[model samples]
Target: MADEKQPAVAPAPDAPREVTSKDGSSHEEITTPTRPPGWMYKGFKVFGHELWYASPLFQLLLVSLVCFMCPGMYNALSGLGGGGQVDHKAQDDASTALYSTFAVVAFFSGSIANKLGVRLTLSFGGLGYVIYIASFLSYNHNQNHGFVVFAGALLGVCAGLLWTAQGTIMMSYPTEDMKGRYISWFWIIFNLGAVIGSLIPLGQNINKVAGPVTDGTYVGFLVLTLIGAVLALCLCDVGKVQREDGSKVIMMKNPSWITEFKGLFETITSAPWVVLLFPMFFASNTFYTYQSNDMNGSQFNTRTRALNNTLYWLAQIFGAVIVGYALDFAGARRSVRAKGSFIALIILTFAIWGGGYAWQKDQVTREETAEEGFVTVDWSDGGKKYVGPMFLYMFYGFYDAAWQTCIYWYMGALSNSGRKAANLAGFYKGIQSAGAAVFWRLDGLKKPFDTMFGATWGLLGGALLIAAPVIWMKIQDTVPLEEDLKFSDETVADVAGAQGAADQAVTAQPEAVRTSKEGGGAKEVV
Candidate 1:
């Protein structure tokens, strides 16, 4: 007979008991795996098993699907340069408002997700997306900038909740070995939303030379987003989620508004090293304005822009896969993978941005002589010229995916607990949105293309430099459980105190050993 599968080991001493379902029908398992497995295992089935519902990969897919509909469609519209409207200014103005509120709300959204519950927060998050897409549909008919801008601001609030919860789940749900792979999977599914959403407009606007996207396009996007929103209600709470190995997700039980807010402050104070990544976060989305508007939108006509947009997001899937595999290369240590990814990011950044600078000079020449603002590169007409800019836009998409994957991977390195992951995700999105807000407003003011391009290049380089010290010196083979892992019922103060005590105890070990040797020549015994 084939060797029988071994039973899982008992849980570690400090690990929490598995949580039970609200209705008491099922109990979460707290067994330990002999070793971490890949995305699949022997006898793995896609459905009709308890493990399938509670699996981290499945949960990650659920969030990915939600994002694929909401932000994915949002990206499809945004990538169209002017939200598929002829007027770029209104899109710019609306983006400014959207990101401004997005920054503030996202910063606190982690706490909000914790206090209100991830399911409810996520369900509400999709509402803003629906409303925002509808505003675009209304703008197509009415030309009302005010309503569109208002919708932008409202969506910002909802996006904050959805993304914070999304981040928390992404970071905390996976085993250490699975973090990178999980991110890649989530990104692929999430961006597919953009890819598929782009297809709708690409198909509809294929023949029309130059005009706003049809009402049918917006309605289609709206329906998909609404479906995503309703699906959010189906997410399993963190308390009940179990990893493939049967370990429980670290959760904050019975969190109140007071504790939740206090926990946010503590995440900063306790893990101050995370601030080193703020510049990386800030630079993350800052280049979207230059890439989408100045380059793709200004350079291509309606149909070609849609084609380029589809390819841009398509590039993201490849980018995420590349970086994701690199980060999770099982042969290397986690720290080595992290440091290597950073260096690769730096090389890719310079290469892509440097190529962009050369392309921008050519774009500048065309802009000065063109009759209208748009430089009108029709894919059907221009052969050699079209290939260069389209490829450039696609590379821009790749660069974006690599940068974001690195950031999420770095943050995931810091902690595995759901509570801390939520705060870190919030901080990242908040800073990213703040930076985007500034750059989008600049685009609205009609900043020189060269200026935007130069800023993007400089900011990316500087952010990478600022993050070097932490990536090199601070990242470890593994985070200490005593330091990062916490009991569900512990308050912020209790968690901090435990960490402080752990530090003190660690620091005192050498001194005690020295004293013992000196007092009794008990070096061996001691």
Candidate 2:
């Protein structure tokens, strides 16, 4: 008889162990103390054991679904050019209102998320999307742009909360090696909401040549967003989540409101390198108004716009996958992947935007000569002019995904702690929203199309130039565990099973600055 195989022993807390991958490869992973099974999943048996509802992947899936129903549906409507209205001005003004509030609230929403917990924050966030969608429905009948703008303002506040929590979880939940793929998965599911939601308008008004989206289209979106609001409540608390390797997710204990703000200030002061990415963040969402209203909305008829919106989101999925795989490729070091992605993005950015520039010039030329403004292109145009613009729009979608994926990956590269991730996410959204607000207001004011277009192109190039040195100097093969876990009074006991011991050694100590094992570390917990 063959010798009995011995049971594998678990690694001690904070011990490094070699973990085998499914591809018959292995790498070292540090194990954090594991928590007891969450009460929510207790006694819920599956295959003779408790189901892991508090699993990292499962919780990520839950968050993805929530975004899918909320922002996903919102994107579908936005893609229809001016929220599927004949006039672009109303939608542009509403967007300006939305981003204006978003900039302010998102800057501080990280503290709110940390205080209220992700579940409540996310649930509250979903409510704004519901109301925003309804505003569109009301506008469909009453044509009250004020109601729409009010809804946008309200949604911006809620969005700040929702997205800060989401960013925390997305950056924190995945293992270091899996961050890219996890982001890709979340993005795919989230955008599916847009793709499926776009179909509602397409199916409802497929035969209609050129007009606003039907009332039924808004109704469909409203229903899905409501479902997402409820789903937000179902997320498991952070401490309960366990990774595939049995380590719990990293989280710092909550401090006072004063302390949290101080922490934010500290982050800004100490990690000033992060400021380099501000231009990139600011430019991130600024292009949406132009893409949605100026390009897709102005150039295509209702049915064709719907079709282009579907293809646009579809391209987003593919773009995310391509970048995600490249970023997470196992053969290269993480730092190598980061540098490689940066280079590829630069190349792709200039190339795609170059195409956009040519297209914009053509549109400008046509508009100058046409007596009645630009004519909307329908599929009936026999693909002469339609196919070229269609491809351009899809590539726009692809570049959007690639750009966003890189930003998220860059943020993820900075740390693995949820608290820090929340702060970073807030800062990112804050700057991004500010830039978007400016651009949306410009579009709303009916600024010259070529002027806005040139600004967008110039900003993208300039931001990348500023961010280049920071990427090369700061990003690394890996983040040190101690550096990542800094800033909280919590210990391994806080996140692990030693719940009763968590508060035993609490003290009012000031923040400590330490040089990380990785050479130059940022400020951390005392």
Candidate 3:
């Protein structure tokens, strides 16, 4: 401060500008390139910036709410109203028909979206959902099983569109580094919606209400459907992204849709492991069928039935959270190791839970009969004698949670790199529907088959559970891409350089030209 300070000298006009890379490398800065208009950065953001907070959350919540309400309405109609024995067979046929339709429609919708883009596809799907819901609400009130089945078929189509588009939107938001975390959060929220959905029926007094279609219960589904339609309209288009040159890039163009569809076919043909994941998914569906069948099949009173549903959802929540966290951590550390080990754990868990149920049924039968001191006990009517252990309920809950977490994470991870995340999700769900269809038929036959029926279904589930790990092991060798980083260092550098160049170019414009353009006149300059 005591010495006189020298003024800073400006750089020479020819002097090179310095630029820094993310890795700390330096380079001569050149005039940056100009970016095309309307290029926006599409990548991960913190908390409120997450894509999950966008329309996806709303869609998910709406879907969950509708799902929750539909079952309640069905249960109230079929079970609560002193209605004659609800045709369980007819219900299965309806569900099967719907699922079959959903599968086919999902495949086509995915292809169409790839062609027409997400917005149109989503809008169409949302509108379809609105129509389907209206139809269902109208017919369900009148106890029109035929119309209900028809409406269900329409709903399936809507589900195909909504689910495919929604899945694509969710996966498109997160970058690789944060994909696992984001997906985990997404599922957690999704399940939370399910929890809320489960509670809707409970609050609406679906079980207690004596009248035909209780107040607010039927209306709740309609409200949810409307909300879903609105949210679907708001979904972000994942197909649009900015290229390095700041040009608009469409991931899948018109001709590319066919190529992508063919690619999906090739993927299935070549990557057999992807196909293998299907059976495990199917096994999980079997459990769901088991639970539904048990609910409908059992003679449990209203309170017990409600308790069963509550427990089922509670277990699902617990399982989803725990397994989701585990999968995330495992993926972070070593994705392959995590996947293999997780699958194995799931398989073992399913085996134990399924085996335990099988054993518990046998044990309870022996205990009850032994207590009666009957040498030749005729336990012909197994309905009165059959008692599932309380512990089995808890075990079943845990198993379901673990199974679902694996399915979601596995499919998400597998399809993350592909343009067909929606299709994959749709296909997986479609297969689940197919499994439900098969098992529902089996459930109908349980009357004549007795305990053998339940045991056979459990065995099939176990077999599928066992197959998952084996298939995963084989598929593990085919390395799928991990999360794709949105803004790589090179990309960032390119952007920064381009921006700097644009600024410099403008700055370098002559004052005379600028003055001329501003109407100061060339004579003034002379």
Candidate 4:
């Protein structure tokens, strides 16, 4: 028989539960994991089994499927076309319109999350996506781009609400020890949309694609969006969430929304955002714009474009999982991690843009389509097999994973106050959106390739170089990066050594020792 496993020993009282931060303040650490996941949701007055939401696995699955339905199928499919592959400009315009609202929508996301909770707020966000996809099917299809823009704004608002709540839940739901792991699971599951959506373009071909898409696509996607929205509705209330130990967090709130609004400003002015998050905001916004306009539009053809999305999304899943381990690496200080990330991101950016700059002329070429109203694009390099540009998306996926993971992890580390963290998440998303909106208006809506490429390098380069240093200097963690096992081992050794020394002292004493008690009873002491 295999040796029986030993149960985990509790920490000794003398073991440090807090650390002195860089700012000279003492902060408590999550010395213990939270309550183990029970049933997803407790049912009735008495329950033995947990609900689906109680399981982190289920929650991950739920969010994954939701992302697939909304952004995965509908948005990705539209990127290169409406039908399958019809009009790039029109579709691109529609996308630009949608992206245009991200700043305003994401700005208010936290306040909305606070009022409505994560579940209902995600539902609100998911519903906009449903409407946007449905709009593509209506007569408004190719008639007016304005309607598409309006619909896109709705999606943006919803996205703002959803992302804020979702970030909060992800950050708050897991125990402190699980923070990195939780973020990894989030991206891992969420990107399923890209994996599945990639296959759709393979069968649909550029010629077969249309303005509103085929009837089956509309009805099928509509149903899919609903399913995702429903899943969002099923999310657990953020306030009344339960920990792994079966302990429930109390739900509390400020007296007014006005007070909450005022608090967001303070969060914006804080160290995490002011010092570390700006470059990330610039980088994320520019990347989204680059992907939307230059890379997705003028750079690659239908099939290759789909491949880019597929590879990027698929790779990000791997990247997210990998980066999660990196962030949680034992005994690795934040300073070391930030430096490594900065160097890696900088190299990747150069590889994507600088290395591929030579092939720019051959990489993207155009031809007149059979339809008078449409323009045909060929991202192929005269069948020369240029692989460099395509790989850029893959590198982007990897960089994206690290960037998102570090930012969120850093956010959790810096802000112990839940309100501040929640607001900061909203602020981060909003700034990201706002930046994208600026890019959409400038380079992406109908941007020339040169401008788009220039912005991509400058923005991403700035992010890696600038933000990386800010992270090293200003972003401090209250929790030590030392591995628990190492710390525990040292503690146990010290305790045992002290005990052994005490025993030796006792042994060295006289064989008989006596002490007199003042109260008449005699007690012997050694």
Cα lDDT of model 1 by residue, 459-524, tens digit: 999999999988987878887655665525643323322223334444556554334333554321
Clash pairs, model 2 backbone: 487-525
Error of 3 at 268 (Å): 1.8
Q: Please give, for residues 1-526, the per-residue lDDT of candidate 2 as tens digits.
A: 2323222343454444666656664544444444334433324443233335777777878999999999999999999998999887778888889999999999999888877889999999999999999998999899998999999999989999999999988998887898998788888899888999999999999998766889999999999999999999999888768764555666656567887787678667868889999999999998887888888887778999999999999999999889987888999999889889889888988999899898887675324422365577887785648888889889999999999999999999988878888889999998999999999999887777777788998998899999998787798888765576675666654444222222221222222223222334332221
Taking all chains together, each candidate's TM-score versus the true structure is 0.85, 0.85, 0.66, 0.73
Local accuracy by lDDT, each model: 0.83, 0.82, 0.48, 0.58
lDDT of 3 by residue, 40-89 (tens): 22343344442222233333443433333333233333322121122344
Highest lDDT against the true fold, candidate:
1
Query: In model 2, which range of ten residues has the least summed lDDT?
Result: 499-508
Ranked by lDDT, the better of candidates 1 and 4 is: 1
TM-score of 2: 0.85
Off-target runs (Cα >4 Å) in candidate 2 are 1-51, 364-374, 493-526
- State the lDDT of candidate 4 residue by residue for 430-507, as single tens digits: 777766666766653455566666776677677666665566665454533122212111222222222332343345
